[model samples]
Target: MISKSTIDKVFESARLEEVIGDFVQLKKSGSNFKGLSPFTDERTPSFMVSPVKQIWKDFSSGKGGNVVAFLMEHEHFTYPEAIRYLAKKYNIEIEETEQNEEQKQQANDRESMYLVSDFAQKYFEDILWNSEKGKAIGLSYFKERGFTDDTIRKFGLGYSLDEWEAFTKEALDKGYSLDFLGRTGLSIIKENKQFDRFKGRVMFPIQSMSGRVLGFGGRILVNDKKAAKYLNSPESDIYHKSKVLYGIYHAKQSIAKEDNCYLVEGYTDVIQFHQRGIENVVASSGTALTPEQIRLINRLTKNITVLFDGDAAGLRASLRGIDLILEQGMNVKVCTFPEGEDPDSFAKKNAYEDLVLYLQENAKDFIQFKASLLVEEAQNDPIKKAETIRDIVQSISKIPDRIQREVYVQECSRIMDISEEVLFNTLAQLGKKNVAEANKKFKKERKAFEVVKKEQAVEKIDVQYQLERKIIEILLLYGNRTEEFEDLLLKENEEGELVLEPELHKARVFEKLYLDLQQDEIELSNENFRTVYYGLISKLNEDDSFVIESYINGLDSELSKEVTSILMEEEKYDLSDWEGKDIYVKDKAESVAQLVGETILNLRCFLIDKRVSDLRQRTLEKKDGNNHEILEEIMNYHQLKKLLSTKLNRVL
Candidate 1:
């Protein structure tokens, strides 16, 4: 288990914006940072991070908490794993006790798989550097490819031994489970026999954006016609190839910093670029481009420059990915190396400056590149020319922004020398067809239960729930603040009527809220709110100086989530720039006393209204002829409600 001191150190050192910015491209908004929701597919930014509060909220998905929560949610990390990730990111040393055998065995299946994959990576790396066969084969291959020792180790490149059972046998001897080893595809087991999957191959670890080893891609060294040259780990609980991009772990920051990503096809292509000082490059790992992979790049930048080999067939085959990039509302540019050269070879041959210069000079807008390449094939053929124009129009239709689509349409017209009217007409037909097909698919896939659910009436507002939530929000934001409040005293007036007399008193907000709720014998209706409410009050009572970050970190996930939602509810409006537009936003801090008193009064009014409702129901039932008592009770509650409503400025 990680020590409390270490966790605290992590919370203190790990900045929420900096950590989340590594995954999502965050732009400054007022006092906070805002970005597209990583949890949801959004065109506009709804994910917000508050550096002042050290908490983040995704208004789109309603997921919010401190830095740890963001990691847990975005990376699917367990709590301990999240803490460790933050610790590593901030360069804080973790103080953790060694896990016992039982504890290690108790880890979940996915975590165990992760452990096995990580172990495999380390084991492979050790072999590459230390083992005789590894140094002779794996080290030699990497050196021959023009990779320095630092570059090889930076990518965690390693080698698996030539013998079939070498990795499998060593892993078992070291207490790593065969189940996980086989599951990670590090070892293949069949018919009660086990052998290494990447025998006689060098290893290239495929890592997640956070640098966790998800799997590996191994390339064989020797010319064995019977064996495939390159192989990847099979799909497992941890690794999904389509969703994984090679070198994302190293390239994410550079991609975000440069505001562009370089796309290539193979692992070597990504490594060579990074080796050449072009860090914002990732590869598809030889898989066809996927929406999930595109979205990964989309998180860092809106621009993608796809690097292609000069082979005409390969370039043509990769054209489909440009359409995919456009579909994700990203700007795409394509660059191709000279014939007989790919990204790996070209980068190897060029100096860093030349490589950078070549990419800058050769990169062409996807439309221009697509047109030029297709025009050659369509030369002197009218039918093929029309088809090519239609194809370009279809690609243009994939762009989500209307203005961008229009701009691209004009560009395509100029490139192909086609009439703007003809291209626009074709685009309209394609749009209609797409919409019709989408509707048909939606109707066909629509479940009976979903239709029934949609037909259900909207739920009415829960007054008690709203009031309870409001009280919690007030407590979280201003509980530690000491404010002078207008205390309402119930007394007999000149007319012998129950009257609320206002008296000024100074007390901490939590003290005032606590006394009010305690006097009324009220409890929050929502269980989550009740837990957070009591915990928050207890913390405030214990310490005069309340730190929301530490308090939130101490709570369990559910309560932490609730507290974050409450704390960040007001932050949502920060993105609106109301003050910049000459509309002033009310500072809640200035009205802490009134806000606290009003929330308490609202809760009291809601509860009293509920009691009155119950009393009225009892009178209607006429239970045991207690109508007289019920009427008197109802009248008293009504009077109380009236007094509270007066203070709240609400009609009874």
Candidate 2:
């Protein structure tokens, strides 16, 4: 168990804005920082980080929580794990309880995998740097490509020994699971034979944007003609090649700082670019550009500048990705190196400032770049020329934003020498076709909801019960306080004799519930609802106003999900509409009124009955009271029963 004091210290030290800002690119919007929702794919920014409240609200996900809770939600961290992550992020040393032997042996699975991967990364990196074999092979390979030792270490570059079973044996000896190794695709298993998957290959650690090692990519050094040149870790739960962009871990800060992303084709190109001081570039790692990967970049910046080598095939291949960038609603520009030179070679020849300057000055809109590149092929050929113009218009049509599509369309018309109206009509038809296909796909799914007085009624009833319980809970929590009620009380006369009073203003519903709960034992099952409910109870104990909205808003989503589901979904039991429909509920919404009358009458009858039983038992035992005392007590009990019966009948 984590100590409460430590939890409090961690919470106090962690700043919500500072923590959330690490994952989200927050820009100041009035009092809050509003940015694109990391939880959802969005074009406009809706994730709000409130520095004042020390919380974040992702409007898209409807998730809002304090810093630790955000870590818990976003990173899937357990409560203690989340605290540890925050403590690590803020540089706070952890204080934890000493665990029993069972707990000590039971390390968290995800953390264990993380530790194993991290250890493997360092071990591989060390071999790359220190071993003669690594120096001869991996180090030589990187240095020959212009990567400095610092850059090698920065990326955790490594080499796998040519020995097939070396890594697997080492990990197994250290008590790491072969199952995990197989799961991460670090080792291949076939019919009880296991070997290192990246044998004799240089390593590139594939990382999440937060820099955790999801998996790896490796390149074969030997010129085995039949062997694949490069191999990536198989798609595991942690790694998806299409969605994972190499070097994003290193480049994200720079991407956000520069407000632009430089997209590249290969891992070495990324390493070389960073080695040359282009910190914002990320690699596609040989996969075709995917919207998932592009949107990851778009999280940090809306503008992407794709760098292609000056080779003819490179330029041709670059066009394939441009359409995807536009489809994602990103501003894209294309810049190519001179013939036979790539970003690596060009950067080695020029300084960082010079390269950035070159990019800024030479980068062209996709429309202009495409037209300029294809213009020669279409020159003096009307058939190909018209096709080229339509091609540019079609790319423009892929953009989802109407205004952005319009602007690009106008630009295309000017460059292609086509009339604006004709191109507009063409783009419109293309967009309509795309929309029709997408709508057909969605509608065929047969998932639609209509409000035809249909509801999950049991859920509604559960919610109404919860509200009445809330009132009951409040009354029980505050019952000690003086409360309003129509109760008869007895007053003392001058001679210290009691006089019966007709009415009294005491026993508020809150007070009654509080006292009753004090005399009873109960526990709330749901933890979050329990906390807020208890908080309300304590306040009512102090006779303060119970603030529901503040409590609801402050709760973490798991709880808010329930409470909001309760408050928002509860209807029909309000009773006013039933009355409007001329439907008289026998009890109407009068839980208290019905229970109150019934209970008073039942108690009156039960007491009259109990007195008769008690007198009978005691008189038979010949204890305490004789038949005369029993007669007086019975007569008095009958008189009290008459008053109770009259009051109960009147109320009912």
What are the TM-scores, per candidate, against the unseen true structure? 0.97, 0.72
In Å, residue 100's CA in model 1 sits off its true spot by: 3.6
lDDT (0 to 1) per candidate:
0.90, 0.74
Alpha-carbon deviation at 46 in model 1, angstroms: 1.4
Cα-based lDDT at residue 280, candidate 2 = 93
Backbone N/Cα/C clashes per model: 0, 8
Error of 1 at 314 (Å): 3.0
On a 0 to 1 TM-score scale, where does candidate 1 land against the true structure? 0.97
Q: Across residues 115-217, which tens digit of lDDT does each residue of candidate 2 receive?
A: 6677678878878888889899989998888888789889999998888987888888988888888888888988979999989999999888767788888
Off by over 4 Å in 2: 1-9, 78-81, 95-101, 104-112, 312-314, 439-443, 446-530, 536-557, 560-652
- All candidates: CA RMSD (Å): 1.7, 11.4
Candidate 2: C-alpha lDDT? 0.74
